[model samples]
Target: MIQMPLQDMIKKITDGAGISEQEVNDKIKQKLEQLSGLISKEGAAHIISNELGVKLIPETTGRLEIKNILMGMRDVEVVGKVTHNFGIREFKTDNREGKVANIIIADETGSIRIVCWGDQADKTSDLNPGDIVKISSGYVRSNQERNEIHMNDRSVLEKNPEGITIDIGPSAASRKKIEELAENEGNAELLGTIVQVFDPKFFEVCPECNKRAKPTESGAYSCPQHGDVTPNYSYLLTAYLDDGTGNIQAVFFRNLVESLLGKNAEEILSYKDNPSAIEQIKTDLLGNMIKVTGRVNKNTMFERLEFVVQSVDPNPNPDDELKLLEKEKQSVEAQAVTEEVQ
Candidate 1:
């Protein structure tokens, strides 16, 4: 039920009417002139959309795609492949004690996160990456400025729905500054200088399943599924990155830490027992400019935003970065206007 984005409306008009985007813009400009600037640019676009017989409202299409699942929608059904399973998270508040399951699903159009609650949350127990999923009777809500589908006890989730298949490519990361981040982003790129780097904390993961291994009563760690066995080590490195406008705490996992510090995994593990061994490396990292693209995770326990680094680029081309950021700025502005009218 949310208002369609102004750019989306313009695209609809241009594509549906088989006219150039410039022509659509020219038409909107004429409409604004006729109205003597009484209406906003977005209003003019919507008027032009209607004049060109382009419908801005979402209709009940068969098997709705994630990208078309607009905000403020209810009782919606969608089918997509499970791209990621965030597992279950339990929360206890003053009067409520419950858990929610989160998973990201993708179709050819796009991807989105779905939050499952109550009995519906149990349905995610067996979900894995690359599994087709069908969700019915769900509602979409805005969380941290992004759209997410919510499933309550009334919703139904079908795992591996028959004859349903989805072909999706990789999702693109949005480029923005640290101050522009608000945890709504799925993946974001930030170019900043490392102001500080902390010692990495290493842990054990089951070699077979890659699940975290918990310490046994005897002190040796073991995975829940694989019993007592040798485990591979993983680590997370934390650093503060400043992009002039603001700064953010960024965390890089074991795989990306090597590139982040220009060191190998074995070299990083050597410092696990001797924390001071990394001081020189840490000092070298400070003031070094790098770019990171990753998920924006809110560390509930720490009560702060942390960027989970997925990819690292020690150097980026300035001219290309400026062009991308400018395009992103326009997209952000149009989304802001859409939210306003909604």
Candidate 2:
């Protein structure tokens, strides 16, 4: 007989309703199989934690007591005040329909939005905003914005009413520097703050557009529906240093955003399906502190230096860049000192 966690049981019940005891058992079996697929490593870790009587909480939910949580995990216990809850509602789409809830929770670490489902929705409703609660088995899922964590039914909630404890960590990752990162090729890590920003403009078409836009008599440009055309410019710049044999500065352009945030780019391109959207994004990329991991190659169109950014932090902030820059400065100074001593 498998002793399933209450949170897991709640997920099984909420995911599929109006079930019988035998069905629940079957669901448990299926859940175990599914869990094996989704959480083999985490399950093993949980088993060991259980044997050791260790508690785990999601990184965003708890106080500083349980700060060592790993990344990309589920099932953490946290104690926090219920800042708010938005009840439940139907979320309809061409593909499917379901329910979702929004709640605000906070501990010493910080605050974030949490979403509840099914029974978890009801459980959330019972508690008034500002009431402190001790939540067990609360799992973290990315919010609709894909930027932060939200909770769901696979999690458990209890009204603490008193004070609750939670764990905390750095709200974001630190980024490197450009001067330090301008070395060689290979997998590089860099972090820097955005020191500059450029404006965005509109575009019509180039010779590249086989159909859409056409050239104007004034040597400007024009499109079919978009009319006498101008390109849209948007820039997003961040600083990063690649930690290869030596540090190397890295930068990303429109192509990198197309790779990392294609969905958003697609939305902008929906009306025209032209190069204007990409140009807009690039123009808007200035003064945005960024950490990029990619290669350093000479800009064929420019000078002896250029950075081809690969992946970047979609959600970056000021403090993260400051800390990373400080660390890199220290490392560089240390290396310089050593060379002088030698």
Candidate 3:
């Protein structure tokens, strides 16, 4: 039921297939008339694009701002700087193999993750942090509570195209109180005190596939992808964060947890059986003011909003914050004095 604009669909068809705009328009009109209300205009455009071997960019031109992207939108275009690029990783299934890469792209409005699949993943190999790129014919989908743009075979990747200039800079993450957090608001930054640190635990993962390993009756762990194999350890940390307005549960994965704890998974795993060591670690994290950045999503398991922490800053400077608070307090007192004088 997703619909793209008619003009965008036409442009995609012509540009992708190297056909004239008139030719694509004629074919689209023919398809619409032949279908005779059986399909919508966007649907007919898709059909025409498929028949002509044109990769239709979803419903938008590449000029749409990052903040305006939404779920279920097709052929969305965006231009932004690459803030973080996780190099390509390969995977295999029973029948085939493929590669995928993920990079965080940011504009002045905000940031979103771009997932490039198959050969398109290779196309992004030369991209580095601070490189401005344009994504064309990409599709939008909501992963958890994050808006993600995915590039398929038909998607276009343009690096620093002429005549287009984006002022490259760090994407600003909006500061939100715990109570103000909403699902699918893109990326967010929150400042809160860690009210509680749940017990940290390590989960066994498949060495080959990196998915959680399943325990078998034979006292060995099995991975669905690679069968029986020696498992690797991955950390999962859960905690509650509270600002004055409200409290929310936050989850951190291996890398973020390592950064916050100042230790790697192996070092923490060494103390797994030592209850006192684990308790000491948890105690250290409690009552600390930290800033966390990540996507907010509905945790189906808990049936509530949960934050998936991507990055954490344990020691952000508070001088500016204190000055701002002082300025606000002084303004309030000045207003009260003015009222008394009146």
Candidate 4:
């Protein structure tokens, strides 16, 4: 069974059924009343999708394009040219240890993050830039708001696969002002100043799988797959970024967290034991200019929109900023003139 976020499910339904989001919500509410609130909103939406003849998952036998792959899809297959290799990271848990490899691949449509785990990660070492790879039996997972094709134990990885060629292109992210960002918009680039920064929050996860672990009946935390284990710690950092147009809430995960703070993983994770250690870092980030590319997600729990950053550049080119400034100025002047003519 495919488990996707409720908002994402609603998005697919509204797009497929040619209906407004409000109409879909009204129907879901009606369904809840009819069923005495027995079923979940997601289940109601799924039923509505089926009744409208809107298929949530595409039915096909061939490989999919990167753009067509959605979060929560399973048994996915895609072939693309490897654009970059991020190298492999190894982690250990009480029960087992494994490696994770992150690679960026692109097709004519767009690029995506392919995360290989365990044995599949080893295969990535043989891959190089411009090499073609075919991924089979992969699962699509949403990290923050971006969809990544994850290959686990049941997945297949083929390097320099025959009969495969992809016309790779530059990243498809749209460079937009903070004010111009829209919910569900993926691969967006924002150049802005750090208006505000929050103290980092640390959390525990299963080291082997890197999923959230919870307390068991006993005192120790346990992973559903890894059983009772010593958990590894990770941190989350959030800040408000402002370009001249507006400000947006931006979130940075583990990999980019170190880059943002100019600290190594150990130094950042050390804050878990001493919570007060991050005050200096938090103070340093304020008022700094940075460039970020990420996906904008409607933060349902917080009831606001947020940018889940995938990449960060602490020092961006000033010339590029000047060009954008001029472009924005012209756009504003053109808009004012059009308004006057109207």
The RMSD of every model to the true structure, in order and in angstroms, is 7.2, 17.1, 12.6, 12.0
Ranked by TM-score from best down, the candidates are 1, 4, 3, 2
Residue 204 in model 1: shift from native, Å? 3.4
The per-residue C-alpha lDDT of model 3 at residue 4 equals 53
Model 4 score (lDDT): 0.87
Q: lDDT per residue, candidate 4, 278-326, as tens digits?
A: 8877888889999999988778688789999999999999998899879
Error of 4 at 114 (Å): 2.0
How high is the lDDT of residue 331 in model 1? 96
Task: Look at candidate 1 and give me any clashing residue pairs.
Answer: none
TM-score of each: 0.71, 0.29, 0.48, 0.53
Rank all candidate structures by their lDDT, best first, as comma-separated numbers: 4, 1, 3, 2
User: What lDDT score is found at residue 312 in candidate 1?
Assistant: 97
Best by lDDT: 4
For model 4, the stretches where C-alpha displacement exceeds 4 angstroms are 3-23, 171-342
lDDT per residue for candidate 1 within 55-82, as digits (tens), equals: 7765674468787887788887999888
Model 2, runs deviating above 4 Å: 1-77, 81-89, 93-96, 102-114, 122-131, 137-156, 163-342
Q: List the residue pairs that clash in candidate 3.
A: 4-59, 57-75, 58-74, 58-75, 59-74
Candidate 2 residue 243 Cα shift, in angstroms, is 14
In candidate 4, which residue pairs get closer than 3 Å at backbone N, Cα or C atoms, i.e. clash?
A: none
